[model samples]
Target chain A: MEMTMCGIVGLFLKKEDLRPRLGDLLTDMLITMTDRGPDSAGIAIYGDEAPGLKMTIQSETPDETFAGLGDALTVAVGAPVPLRVADTHAVLILPEGTEAAARAFMTEKGIRVMGTGHAMEIFKEVGLPKDVAARFGVRGMGGSHGIGHTRMATESAVTTLGAHPFSTGDDQCLVHNGSLSNHNHLRRSLTQKGFPPSTENDTEVAACYISSRLAEGASLGEALEGTLDDLDGFFTFVVGTKTGFGVVRDPIACKPAVMAETDDYVAFGSEYRAFANLPGIEDARVWEPEPATVYFWER
Target chain B: MRTIDMATTPLRDLNSTLQAAAASGEGQWEIVNPKGSHAVAVGLDGPIAVTIKGSTGYYCAGMNKAAKIHVTGSVGPGVAENMMSGHVIIEGDASQYAGATGHGGLLVIKGNASSRCGISMKGIDIVVHGNIGHMSAFMAQSGNLVVLGDAGDALGDSLYEARLFVRGSVKSLGADCVEKEMRPEHVEILRDLLDRSGAEAKPEEFKRYGSARQLYNFHVDNAGAY
Candidate 1:
């Protein structure tokens, strides 16, 4: 028994009908890869919202008690402040120019926040699938694409906030398997450039690093492909964007990832058994995506 | 003989389908795309022969009664554990603990095998063509391990009554276990075993090995190390 890595399941639907009815599709897929994750599970459903930003707070605090972490976000452009506060997280709608101030505030409070565009929303917690969903208010939630995480906890603490799909700014959420051997070096680089990390987990550093690259005009696929040359370790990752989904594998090919594609949807997991029960897949046309390759699906 | 393609079929549905075919008095079964399955030919009570086309997860033919199982790809842990009768042939590699605690059966691997090949065997015949991993026959009470290739360290650590034969180098022999002369009787026995496994190698290409008899009843010298 080697060290267990994270289980990441991604779903991309061609139609809106497949998006809303994704609970069963995702549940069946995740259960097949249960061996990869036995500690916690979560989902981030990207829905149709104004082109804006979404932030997820991963720290020790009562931020989730704030009702409607969903409704508080807005597509404004000026100042940034929390519209509501939840149990251990909060929902804030920041104006465009206030991105600097908002990040500064969260950093000062020792609260880790990653923001993606409004196309993606992330909800995660510790426990099984049903428990995580019930705790995170996933029902009736609509999104075009979603990414999920089930944790086995090889290194990081098993905290609710630590469950993935983590964000970098808004609409950009990431889930990862395998450890980053060069995290300290990467973290030093980011913190020197005013991006002080909140958590000791290496995944946070990876999120920020990719976010930084994309902000510098590097496409999602390019940034992920760039990671293979720069990062040193075994890892397989999937990131959800508003327009599409991105996937990558480390150079070593130590971790496993299986992907299944059809006109209706494209799904991937750490094991072949995970995608065996997709609803519309009448034939088993699954393939193990080669290591060091990045896949981009925009629909 | 009957052939079934299990490419996209659910495992439960395939199991029931095979059972139905057997109930109808089928003598031979061939399965393809058997990706990572456990207990494939379990509890069969007839003169049946089955060949699995691909790799399996665990316990491929556990507690087999009277059926022969042949696997085309590698097998995970416990290939024929606790098998009662019949044969299991592997065309490719095998993982750890193959033929573990088996009472009676014949298991043959055409390729390499991992650790603990014949652990706690009451009675069985396990033949390997390629190299074996560490702890090949641990705590084996009674069985026969014929290895055409090299064996890893600790071939037999604790032995009650088990016979082992190796053609290549022994990395490290376990406590109270040493090499012995291969008599003409043993050579003839190995020749017959090789022919049964469909191996084309000559009988003289293999050598015989077993316990050094110092461990038959443990003494102070053998007791401290093991």
Candidate 2:
């Protein structure tokens, strides 16, 4: 069987001063893995939380879709809504308790919500890593932690929705490397449990699976550990929450994964090259992640 | 010494340069800043010595012949896969299928090796100083696999003719694989392989494993085993 290789990278800064370099370092890491996936790329950045909730939305026709969207949303919710447009995506900041109202409005307007959270802002597109990073100006943004993925679309179509860093929970996202064997079955089960997956991508199912586990009062570590038993197939997943970064591989560990940690930060990559050029990497403790073991760091 | 810097040069150019050097019978090459590139120093036929300074991605030093390759860092899946002849040494851990279906070579891993270390091997000699993952030597036709540390589940499934030696515990044996007596001849072979691969484990500390010879031909008595 031919495996569709993808690339996953994550960085959690342990030092406050290094926060400004997160996007720059992550961009280099994602671009180094361009050969691993050529179809699409996505990144989720965890930055400062505004006074309200931020929802990222994407559109095929941004000019028509985003025109006067802020005023229209403000009118619908009877609250001031601020919208920031980036190439094909827009970030809408709404009051704390207005997520459901905003989501309903988006559904009626046919605008696709990519992710919604207090701290996370996601940007993804169907293009090379370099172009996608440029499209969103990822290199200029600053964050404390972030996760990125380059997709080589095997299970789903090559579209913005199919890109990774799939967010199924507030302030949470997941990027996966290998395919799931029982995703179709698990997808139906998850849908019945009220965590309905929206994409045909198996990785979306995995994201929702983790989100549902967390919703059941499982810690991030416990949720990742559950994957070893419930998720059947080879996978190396890098999951990020508002305050933690976690990594886990399948029991067989058919995919490639390596991690490096320094006093300044902890990093995960499909291969070592992704973090090889990061600051203070020369003295970092680099090792391959043990199979079926969950490694996570929380701030 | 010829040096190829992956930081400044493209992968294709580096591979073509190595191919040209091999054609001229030149030896002693060094790859600086490999940066996890895949398929480095592959398909070399001449007796050359290549040292990769950093880690590499999948299929590094693959399909090699008459060359000695050394990687200072770890390697990804299928390292030395389908190799015909030569010595490939990894200073760090190796990913899955370390020496899959290699016809001939001496591949040594100083650190642990992931699943399928010597799958379908056809005459290659592999030595791992550390543990190996599951399904190792599966469907192995002919070769020698030496594991100084423990082996994971289903070791040597559907094995054929290949000799296996493990110094540590095996979680479980495969359908057609079982423990075999370590005769003086087997001891001699294990010692030779250990010496060639530079493994420090003594031959006397090892135990031999091989096919049970029941699955060679279809028989109703062995149908359940299959």
Candidate 3:
């Protein structure tokens, strides 16, 4: 398996004052774990919410795909749809009640939609995590919470589409560090349930699973707990909602996971080494997350 | 005192320096800013003391013949694995499969140890002041595992020969593993282990577990357990 199989990191800020530094801190943590996986990397930031909606899209040829995209959306929405470009991904600020039309417009133009929400913006590409992060200026972006993955690609190809932080619902994303033995079967059932995963990536099936659960009114903790029974394989999932960060590991927990929480933030890493540079980490309550347990933090 | 700063020096230099230390060399060495690096002081055959000021990643002190190594922070997977003869202490928790397949040594963890703490251990003496995770001591052939707190699921599954001492309740026992009477001799061994590891639990309050030796010969009827 050429795998994006290791190095998962997340940071959830409890102190609102640290929001501006979330990306910088998470970037440092992500870069520190470079040795775990180097095939591809991705990040999902629950940053400041725009007035209407934020839809992030990625393309192989950004110069042609992104040019005039904002102007075209503005004409279609009958309002200015502000755009921000970072590397191969671009975020479009859509006007209220225009998501369906904009979705159709982008689809007709054959655009790859990454995620949609007011606060969540995702960036992923096929490269080393440090280089990917630098290309997107992840160090300068500000957010209240974010999760990142550096994949090694064991079960699938090392393509941008196969990278993690899969977003199946607005403001919700997931990063995984293990493979699923029953992803094909699970994906079939999920597709039947209207949560068809867009990629062959196993992690995307899990992301859709969470989104499907939340759409059915299951709480974040309940959705995470559901994973233990329905999913079969080794996994350490760090999920992010608009205002929440949740974690769960398989009952076996063969894949490594560690967490540290302080008065300011809650953090997760596949190893303690990822937390070495966080401020006040020496005083943080660092511990190993228990197997088959769901740990959630909301601000 | 010799101080090695890993932030400025690569891990190869640190390990080579320690591995090259003369067997007669007896002095104190300190490592700073380990930043969760792996194999910090592996394959040491000297008589010296090294203190790591921070936490470490995988295989902190593997195949150690001599040299006492201590860590002030938690460690990742397989800490002190296959140690020959020495003392390795972790002030914080240890990740998975610590001290696996060791020939001889004493591994002490003051905090909890994750899954399979001493799987397939040969002759290492491990005393954890905190709880140990699931499937620990599985198929362990020899040596002793002492836990002060509870053990997770399937303790000593398919075990062999290794003696297990737990002061707290066991979640469940694995196949062919059973609780044994803590005879005076067992208590003496436990006492010695507690004393050496500086753990303060009373030997009288503990229970000993070992293999039933039913699967030793691998009969067809016992094949299911394997």
Candidate 4:
């Protein structure tokens, strides 16, 4: 009933050279949660891609299609973005100035786009770490702070959309483990709050719920704490932004989350192996987050 | 017969020696003073008896095939992860996720075992003489998990294809989990398993816990709850 492993990797690099290490470090971190998820893998990387904000474009296939209007998307985004079309995914990296227009244009074009501070690249095809890593080319260009998902495919169908690191309409994304018993109610509430719901996933509802609160000028910590009062369920989620990260466990705390902190960086995961995988942290002091406690760290 | 003093031997050298001993078809092997070392007797597949004199670390007898392993002290996470077949007897407390995803084997923990014991177990018999932590036998595919002591909260959460026996109080049941009537057949099985493990408790004292068949196959009715 409960998902065991969840992970988040954030690094404030002493030097720019340390950024590349995030790939192998994230690979090691994500692989440790293999028991939690064996179906697909995805990562959201935020590095030197663009100084300004980036937008997330989500699309599906068959009935909800968007691949037909590639030319319109290119002009609207104002960039000849590489469109990696899977059965369900079609993405374009919009520049900073065009983010709002791109969001609106994609909305009219029937493509769901949200602005996120972190550049998210999600790849989900069945394979081992090497094959998955090759698809996103994460072998060389790992970023400073990234979150990964390895899903066991319990609640929702195993698809790239169900893959985590769900982005809000702004520069925030979230990855979650554990089921939310009250996702339906939360989704209904979020829709009433003027937030458009995309996936049928409860995690997406949670992402939007938090994002809507943040849009009301709430701090990340305030939004998280506020959700605890309203949202009900068992979930341990790690939400990431460009300059900050936050982790919150459900009130019941059925899920597991361990954190290791050093002077330079912070790492948290459902298991100890993720912390063990980070370099320059051969002896990072690790501890588990208490139940109902929300932790926030800003770089 | 063979004996390796782990106090002076590294795990790499000692594991090789134990493998050699098992390949030699030695009836008995002893690891004296195996203090907090990890991966002891892992993947050993032979008709051999191993006795680890002290505490061990994670995956102590992981993926074991035929050998019978005895740990004299506490064991860390995943004491027998994915073990194929064998007997692992723990004389002391066990840490988290003990016997996780094991396919086949008999895990006898004389002392308490921590959470997620026998999680996703396919075909195994785990006998815990002391209290068990939360989520014991979670999502177990097929196996017999016998607990002689009180079980912590959420026993047998989302359980499947597993038979569970607990002699003491159960804190709570997980999603789709329930308490079943302990039939005479279950009592017989428990008796036999306890006899084999040399446990003193009687089978009649134990209660049975298992899946309620609610969240077995994902129906819309049981969505989000699991």
Candidates' lDDT values, in order? 0.71, 0.90, 0.91, 0.73
Error of 1 at B141 (Å): 27
For candidate 1, the per-residue lDDT at B18 reads 62
lDDT of model 1 at position A70: 31
Worst 10 residues of 4 chain B by lDDT: B29-38
lDDT of 4 by residue, B1-226 (tens): 5788876888899888777766777478889766446688887878789988766656899888888999876676789899888899998777677888888879999878867888899988999988887778889988899999988778899999799899899988888888899888988989999999989999989888888887676798767776
Q: A1-299 in candidate 1: lDDT tens per residue?
A: 11356678888887776777676667666655566787888777776674345555554555443333333322222343445343344545555566665566556656656454665556676777666655555655566778887888876678766677777655777888878789889889888876656677777777877777777888888878888887777778898767868889764454656666777888877654466567654343444454577988876
Off by over 4 Å in 4: A1-17, A49-51, A56-74, A77-97, A107-115, A118-129, B1-226
- Winner on TM-score between 2 and 4 is 2
lDDT of 2 by residue, A26-114 (tens): 99999988888889999999988868998999999999999999999998888999999999999999996788889999999899999
Candidate scoring better on lDDT of 2 and 3: 3
lDDT of 1 by residue, B37-102 (tens): 556666565557888886666678777766788987767667888878789898876666788888
> What lDDT tens digits, residue by residue, belong to model 4 across residues A1-299?
23444333433333456677776677777766666677777676666655444454555442346545556666767765445443444445555576667668766866655335535444444445445656556656567677767766755566666666687655577878777778888788789998866878877888898889888988889888876887777788888776667888775565656666776567777655455546655445444564566888766
**Which one is best on lDDT?**
3
* Candidate No. with top TM-score: 3
RMSD (Cα, Å) for all candidates, in order, is 9.1, 2.9, 1.9, 10.9
lDDT of 3: 0.91
Candidate 2, DockQ score (0 to 1): 0.48
In model 2, which regions exceed 4 Å deviation? A1-3, A280-283, B23-26, B217-226
Q: What i-RMS does every model get?
A: 6.4, 1.7, 0.9, 6.9
Binned by DockQ into CAPRI classes (incorrect, acceptable, medium, high), candidate 3 is medium
Per-candidate TM-scores read 0.58, 0.92, 0.97, 0.58
